[model samples]
Target: MAGVRQFDEDSAFEQALEVFRAKGYRATSMLDLAKSTGVQRGSLYNAYGDKEEIFSRVFERYADRFVADARVALNKAGLREALVEFFVFAIRSITQGSPARGCLSTKIAVEIASESPRQQELVKKMLDELEDVLVGVLQSPEARAQLVIPPRQAARIIVTMTRGIAVMERVYSDPKRLRQTASALIDTMVRPG
Candidate 1:
């Protein structure tokens, strides 16, 4: 294989995603990407296009995993259990690895989405997927009998609370307290009125 360079894209994406997630989109430079990925700056540009495009790729990778996790959470037998699993998934996602990186879609949704239409659409897509799953869960037989609010409103509240937990995890490192708070909120939100 003449002139063929071999490299692990998943490994590169992991390295690059960590740097972007930790430092954010604007703070990370091409040099940083090259250094973190162990690839040369020129090669990085050649391989992944510009920094903006590269970031889009990283965001896509993150959304893929998040969507998959949300699907698993939504698969729980009980609505309460499913939503609880979702909250747990959100907390673990934000708290993954050292220094509490938080959710990229959540972080970038606030930080970058407002300014970039492309990013806004991306964030909305991820949220929309989760919300659709949540709506389904809320419409389940058990959840319907104990409905606190309409399915759309309930899903919105759940998604907002989920994002808030992600943001708060950076400030509050104690998982027990966070989970307790989430449980309380879930009970309140889902309680039949």
Candidate 2:
């Protein structure tokens, strides 16, 4: 009889994501994923093809979760508060799983962005969507009333600051400082100019 899958697909994918995020695409091996997910090497190959393919799935999942989580900022009461919280959340998430891991998208974007077209497109699409989210919020009448720059420009600034925070998380694990940095950025943004 063919061996039945003892692993849940969703659970296996989640496990694989953690491994990819921690070790990265070029560093992770099929054995590593199988061992981590308890799925066995042959089975993993049969199901997921190779490390690149598996990491692709993980990358897409990460993108989905990121965009979804980022939308939470828009749901908050105030635009300035939302921008601050949004960046604080990004920094926190980047620093969340393991200090060594940093942010998966940022890691891949910096590491293999030039080499991999897929990675480049994914990073671009996700970031563009995130900035668009910020633009939507910043274009609000409330937000427009206080802005020194255009909404699109303001959104770019917010995204840039948050991306900086994500990069900064590599060396800094202090959530308080991250939050303060984000708060300071927002303070400067909303201040009259």
Candidate 3:
């Protein structure tokens, strides 16, 4: 029989994800993955095919987890509360997390080339899905008519604001300021004056 594999797929993926989260997609080298996953380069290649494949898997996992959390928050008592929770979670994640940086998808979005049509499409799809979820929560037909902006566009604005807040938190560590900004954003979206 061949030698037993020391690292399982899930464990390997988690370690690889940590590296990706810390260094991002373009900066993370195969050697970094090998070191992070505690596997030889040959074994990593055998298991994951390549760095791109591994990055794709990690991205899927991250996106899925984020969407899942957002869904749970959406189901909570009130729309405003859910929005606050979402922004609070995002700010805390970006400001005080282990890596202490902005989102992986956002980081990749900056680096992805226009020539890479597939990556660009994937990013757009991801953002669209996020907007769809937010719109589903903000289901106000009256407001839609009054504003003359589709729910999709409104949802995009909310998501964009949350992402911007996360980026700001990465630069500024004042929790009170972040919380105030999140509160103001939710207030504006919900009670729009």
Candidate 4:
């Protein structure tokens, strides 16, 4: 094996993800990624091309996991529980570290606006996938009975509110407030008619 990687690729990507989440894409440099990942800069370049390439890889993994988690959270027994759990899942996601990093995809979407079309498209696609998952949950037989609006409209509302929660998590960093907000959203959005 002439060029087999000597370091842990998965661990490096996880560290790179943390760096990007903390500092955003443009603020994070190759050296930052290397130091965070414990990987040599030259080795990083050789193994993963450049900063953008590494970010792309990390973003893809994150996007997949995010959507999968959404589906799981939205599959709870009752509509209120499902939506509440989804928001709880989302709040937990953004509040992982000390000061809260917020949603990485949402942060990257705002951070890279007017920068890279490719990154913009990636973010958009992830959002659309999330919205679709919400729609599916809203349209489920258990959820449909309690819906006050069309499933698509409700899904969009959920998506927008989810993004807002991410931003507010950074601003307030209070899980209790976020949970209250989620409860209010569930009440307003899913009242029986």
Candidate 5:
């Protein structure tokens, strides 16, 4: 008899991530994961322990990808260029994706922040990480000495603006408008007064 081929854990996690991305964490069910991953419900439980565990795994994978992308953006030639690339990458990922799912962390933050402390903390961590990356790219010390705005504050502004843009893209299908808005944001940030 031929041996059965088993799906790898990473592949299963990727499938689950796609489902969770399309449907928010609370909205996703075990059946959904099973259907999406081509795994039996019992097998899913055996592999990942539980729904929250699976979500945690998916979240970790997603965060790793996001941070990797941010690192790449920050490593580009100049600060302004890096920031522009970061924003453009975000716009493209959110607007052009198959499921058209916005940022998973952002979606969860807006919906569940008030409901669970754990979720709120996760959201806060995600935002803080993004801000930290922005601060590094903006060259915080120089920006502060110039009195343009404090590094921390500017980082918060960038994260907030990006989050808002992502939310808008999730609801609106106006690609040209989003592209224009993203460009305007990059220009404003890059311009020296």
Candidate 6:
């Protein structure tokens, strides 16, 4: 009981995630994480190690949830419907709040990918997981019949375009524009049959 933490670890991680999403890895400090999380700085360090360790754990959780959500979105009755749902899910992630937080993975990839190999691998693994999910959906009989390109290629394109949408969401902050772009990409890559 002496070593048990009084605070909720998951709640603190969520709070810290919000701060990291808003400020990014380079700009966020341990003090900021502690303040946002409403936990003492010493407690935070003791509970989650340093900022990098905290980030790695938080990022893993985020990526896992994101992929699970993608799987759900791609489970529609039809390929077109599933792809639409998937894009909608992706769009919501980037445009959830005022000023738009964008994709944390995308932010990490662009901001700190070169500086930290561990962080870079995390981003890469997340993207790979997403692509694998897409490929699974695309390779289904319904999806394969509707797809103009191979499942692997189409999956990669969808993943790449989703990253582009993340950037565009920040620039335009217009969900409609992003949806329209996704629809167009779907139209081009997937047959209407």
Q: For residue 86, what is the lDDT in candidate 2? A: 81
Candidate 3, residues 81-164, lDDT tens digits: the string is 667787777666666565575677677777763646766666676777787888877776544443335567768887887667
Q: How do the residues 1-193 of candidate 4 rate in per-residue lDDT, one tens digit apiece? A: 6489989988988999999998999999999998999999999999888888899999988999999998998888888888888998998998887767778998987888459887887888898999999998889876787988889999988889988988888788899999999889889988743
lDDT of 1 by residue, 1-193 (tens): 6345456778888999999898888799999998998888887787777888888888888887888888887788777777788888878888878877877887788788888898888889888888888887888778887777888899988888888787777788877777887898888877633
Best by lDDT: 6
Please, what is the TM-score per model? 0.91, 0.89, 0.84, 0.93, 0.85, 0.97
Collision count for each candidate, in order: 0, 0, 0, 0, 0, 0
lDDT tens digits, residue span 1-193, model 2: 3666667988888998888888888888898998889898988888777877778887788888888899985678777767767876787677775455578888888889789898799888888988998888889998898877889998898888777777777767777787888887777778643
For candidate 2, what is the lDDT? 0.81
- Full candidate order by lDDT, most accurate first: 6, 4, 1, 2, 5, 3
lDDT of 5 by residue, 55-146 (tens): 87787778778867876766776556666687777776676576577788888787776787866776777778878887876765544444
How well does candidate 5 match the true structure, expressed as C-alpha RMSD? 3.5
What tens digits encode model 6's per-residue C-alpha lDDT throughout 42-66? 9988877799999999999999999
The superposed Cα distance between candidate 6 and the true structure at residue 82, in angstroms, equals: 0.4
- Please report the candidate that would top TM-score against the real structure: 6
* lDDT for residue 136 in candidate 2, whole number 0-100: 84
CA lDDT of every candidate = 0.82, 0.81, 0.73, 0.88, 0.76, 0.93
RMSD of each: 2.1, 2.3, 3.1, 1.6, 3.5, 1.0
Q: What is the lDDT of residue 30 in candidate 4?
A: 98
